[model samples]
Target: MDMTGQRTLQVTQQQAWEALNDPDILKACIPGCQRFEPSGDQKFAVAAGIKMGPVSAMFNGSVQLTDIVAPQSYKLNFDAQGGVAGFGKGESSVEIKPLEKGCELHYTVHSSVGGKIAQLGQRLIDGVAKNMAEDFFKRFEAELEKRYPPAEEPIPQQSAPAQTSAGVPVWMWAAGAAVALAVVVMVTR
Candidate 1:
């Protein structure tokens, strides 16, 4: 899947970039993140619990940050495995553009999955990925707001749609797929 989105923050571009690189900030912002530890320079070991469809899996992962351009942008290379559930690997670039009030942060992600996770189907996985992204950003924004409350109340950020295709949310799609799978199994038996 490929993702492209932008968010405006009430903090300076430099502050936003710094927050992105902070392990404590990231751990606080990441949903279901159980452990996030620095491995070495620009590397981290992460363990997270993820629930998609009917399967809840624990994923152990590593992330590497490279192609740094200071406060402007950086590339994130990440890979994770959930044992029997399969694996996911991806790269994303985050760019920060200075704005009048603060900064405009843009990110693009390209990712792929294989094994049992792939058997769950694209639309289902896409929905999950999109929802997870939205959740992560929301948490990040909230954390930033807590740290840097504006003089005046900042306007609530726009939320991306839960489901970008077929007009159904991720959870609904997961439920539908689960029902369909159950039916197929019953009929085969």
Candidate 2:
């Protein structure tokens, strides 16, 4: 399947990049993720429990970061297996752009499933994937707020109280893209 989207965040590109690569932040933000232990440089051993409809499974996976261009973009390769439930392998890319107030994250994923998961109708699988994507972003956004709350601007005591400009922060998490599909498909079949 092929998917693409972007989100804005109230952080500098460097801040976004750092958080995206932080193991602790990723483990906390990923839905159903049991562990996100770093196995080596730019590599992680991941375990996540996923539920799709009535199916549920614990997926064990590994992810590698490649083609990195610090604070700009990078490519991620991921694969996972869930016993009889199925398996998935894919490559994805995330590009970060700096904005005046924050930054934007753009991602594109190309992945394939095998075994029972491939047997599931594409429509159903796609629907589930999309929903999972949205859920991942929502959780990532909340985590960002909790971990890196935006600084509050002081109100001017002059003619008018200064108003803080609220940037449209879609929230940035490169890790969000890396594991979202790995976990979502763990239970598909």
Candidate 3:
């Protein structure tokens, strides 16, 4: 499977890069993730519970970051196993571009799967992948707000939603890919 997406973030490029690399933030942002710990330089051990359609399983995996360019971009390689459910392996590239207000996160993923999960079909797998991505972003945004609240400004008569401030790093992008891959594995089962 292949997937691509982008998000507008309410934080500077530097800040987003930093947050993305933080293990705590990544762990929190990845839905159903139970563990996200460093195992080596730019490598992490991961365990996540995922559900798709009528299937669910616990996936154990590893995510590695490569071709890293600080506060800008990186590539992620991920692999996960779920016993009888099946397995997923993939690579993703993530880039952060500065914008007038904050920054944008762009990512692309290519992955393959096998085992019982593959029988579930492509449409189901794609839907689950997209949902997992959305869930990750929501959690990531909330974490950013908590860690770095927006600067206080006087409220205007017409109140607008206050923007939160934060950042992400290359590692975070890797984590996102890991989460997406894990979810895909679950769907296949």
Model 1 TM-score (2 dp): 0.78
> TM-score for model 3?
0.80
| Winning candidate number (lDDT) | 3
Runs with alpha carbons beyond 4 Å of true place in candidate 1: 152-189
RMSD of each: 14.2, 9.1, 11.4
Candidate 3 structure quality by residue, lDDT tens digits, 1-189: 998888777789999899989988998888899999999999999998988777788989999999999989999999999889899899999899999978998889899877777889999988888898888887887888788776876645544443334455444665689688545421110
* Model 3 alpha-carbon drift over 4 Å, by segment: 155-189
Better of 1 and 2 by TM-score: 2
What local lDDT does model 2 show for residue 64?
A: 93
Rank candidates, lDDT, best first: 3, 1, 2
lDDT of 1 by residue, 67-158 (tens): 99999998888999999998989888888999997899888888888878888889989888888877787778777878877575454455
Residue 129 error for model 3, in Å? Answer: 0.6
User: Tens digits of per-residue lDDT for model 2 on 1-189?
Assistant: 888888887678988888788878787767788998889888999888876665678889998999999989889999999899899788889988999988998999888887776777788778877877777777676777777887976644576433334532222233456368335521110
List residue ranges in candidate 2 displaced over 4 A. Answer: 158-189
